[model samples]
Target: MEKYINAFTDSLLNTLDYTWRAMTFDVPWYTNFFWGLTAISLLVWLLEIAFPWRKDQSIFRKDFWLDTFYMYFNFFIFAIVISGVYEILGVLFNDLGITAKSFAIIDIASWPMWAQLLVFFIIIDFVQWFTHVLLHRYEFLWQFHKVHHSVKEMGFAAHLRYHWMENIFYKPLKTFGVMILGGFEPEQAYVVHFIAISIGHLNHSNIKITWGPLKYIFNNPVMHLYHHVKALPDGHRHGINFGISLSLWDYIFKTNYVPEDSGTIELGFPGDEEFPKTFWSQITYGFVKPKKKQPSN
Candidate 1:
């Protein structure tokens, strides 16, 4: 009887895996990634149409298309550039006699699949949250990251409106860190990457979610929306909700802000009031120094 039950559970897991692969067309890695991205984008769009956060009514204008185009453009460009660089680096690392085969933690790929997944996400989120905070506090890094914050409106595509250089620098470090630390194989890393990107996009989405108790565990769209809020003149309402996957760090660090009531809040950079509306302007302005303000006579 025990043997039969074990066999049944194994068969059920295999069946579910088969269904997932079938629905995804069992495509190549790159193709699967793109398709996953498209699927999530479509889901977010449908949610926006069905239940938008803001009732101001002009939120779904031509600006939406423009933002969407910018988002896709950045996503593809970063994917190509970062992947190419990582491939080259990986080859060099292989030639230099460095590999994950020597690492015990990474070799835990032999461990239970669920254990591997848990470790991968925890490590990645730790690195990402620290990196994100560094970008905000550091002036030079903020130049590139500001592009992400420049968005006045919150939506699905708003999450991807980042400078390509940000990815070129940030992604390589992240990939290399994972490879060296636990030696998480590229395929496992890829799966985690897809999940993280999907969740990050959803966090930036304008959809309303009650979340309830889950708010303490996972970051919902409503919580993340507050992170993009423009800073007050006195810098009182500046930084909050710095976590990417889990809200634990934010709460521990006193950065988490759970609003009593959900509502559409003002978003964007406080110092840079004249945010560029055009794609080129937005990307280029970050490179140039802002004009100095003249003191009132």
Candidate 2:
């Protein structure tokens, strides 16, 4: 108990310091997640302004400001909030005699930098893709995920407009992926992080990109737009196009779907009009049981 408390204190302070340096540009440029996210967002927003796939969508799209706040909240504020908990978890796992390297299936530490990054990216992307499918497959998870699907207008900022619970789900699985790769994160792993951010922003941006033949290899705006559609296909009750940074998983698993590229299809899920609009309401949105239909009177 004392150890956990100390871990919490130490992680909280370290997280604060890291966030400050990131914001003040004191960290190396490649590892400066704060500024890196900002730069990518700005660049994508500029692209959306110059060449919008949905020409009618506003520069200030619905929930644009809200989503912008979400980007920072999830990236920085939420990190501060969860740092202690994560540290405690690490301590607990260590006490349990389990370490990341315990699950090591391969040690790519000695692999070429490019190869290490490629394997890391592919494994992490698949993990995220699977987790995304689970988010839709389960009702309890979907309730939280509704915050993201609540988007009525798509844009670059929408990429990060998800419930914080998703971080709880994703981060652990991502760590497990690293564990599988012999718990060896390469020195240049930031490259994978930056590329994932760029692809994710582009995936949700209001800019058309199919990547031509590479559409099969990577997620793009067109394919991901369909992921937010109000209606699912006949058999896809959960969702479709579950890919994150990579579309290959969807194509391989037969979850990919894009009947047309009209770019005017309605976004949002059924009854999204009733979803919460405020940040506080949204972050806490999906934690309770719904009233049982009163036995249909």
Candidate 3:
């Protein structure tokens, strides 16, 4: 309960920081991220255009524009939803008289900015890796996550092409984790997110760049591509290669699966099931559950 309260306090602080910064200076931390995302997307898209990992992959490929729409929609919807959540959490915490200034889990303030950033990032990434695995293994959660894997061809934009619920679930939890572990101010969050998103785009990108020895350190194109592969490794009920930015987590857990190649298997899940093709169907997919089966004699 103390940890949760701590997390809530930081959430409140972060929102106020956003509000104050934007109103006073007209540059919220999130706005910095929005522009950073656009620049990174453009750079990656240009690379994809010139030297695509799959040279056969086309710029006008199916759902290409759809992903762009998803990217833009994600920023808008995320800001709105986060603001609403922050307001509710803020009121509650204020009522309790808990605040970021009142408490902190650790004294990272004395640490160098880069060191503080790195430590907090690893902690959050671990939490995210765990959440991602849950989405793959759990039946109800998989319905939302299926939207992400539905993309037949992975691209940089595919990073944000997730069921909106996925964002709802991830963003709050990550913010909470960062808070309880060690409070993150808006400036700190902005720096870490830029690095995380840049790698995420590359991971989903159609680029053939190799990380070489860094493959063991950071999650790269090859490792992440295997994650989206249809087949799970033997004895694995859920998918493998669950790490995002860092390959180390999957390595420590033994969930990382990088074969000679991902093989020539189809993308998305391998089963009788096929996720919805259009945007609307994908968003509302959670409502359409499978019927219960009759008991056997």
- Among all candidates shown, the one with the greatest lDDT: 2
Model 2 stretches astray by more than 4 angstroms: 288-297
TM-score for candidate 2: 0.96
lDDT of 3 by residue, 1-297 (tens): 565566656665675566445555568545565566778899988887987777677886668888888886676545644564665665677679966544456656668888878877887898799889989999889888988888778889998888888876787677666666555554476777888888989988888755888787799877888888876778777988888789988888889877754323457886525556777777777887644558899
Ranking by TM-score: 2, 3, 1
Cα lDDT tens digits for candidate 1, 1-297: 454455445555554554357446785654365567777788887777777776563547436777787766776544543443455555566767877544434454566777777777777787677777877777778788888887777788787777766776667556655675556653456677777877777787767774788787778788888778785333434467878877777877777775644655777877657666677776776676655659899
* TM-score versus the correct structure, for each prediction: 0.77, 0.96, 0.82
Candidate 2: give the clashing pairs: none
- The candidate that achieves the highest TM-score relative to the unseen native structure: 2
> Model 2: per-residue lDDT, tens digit, 11-103?
999999999998988999989999999999999999999998888889999889999999999999999989999999999999999998999
Query: Which runs of model 1 end up more than 4 angstroms from their true locations?
Result: 1-31, 59-62, 91-106, 186-191, 232-238, 289-297
Q: With candidate 2 superimposed using the best TM-score fit, by how many Å does residue 25's alpha carbon deviate from the native?
A: 1.6
Better of 1 and 3 by lDDT: 3
The CA lDDT at 286 in model 1 is: 61
List candidate 3 segments past 4 Å from native.
Answer: 1-31, 93-105, 262-264, 271-273, 289-297
Q: Which prediction has more favorable TM-score, 2 or 3?
A: 2
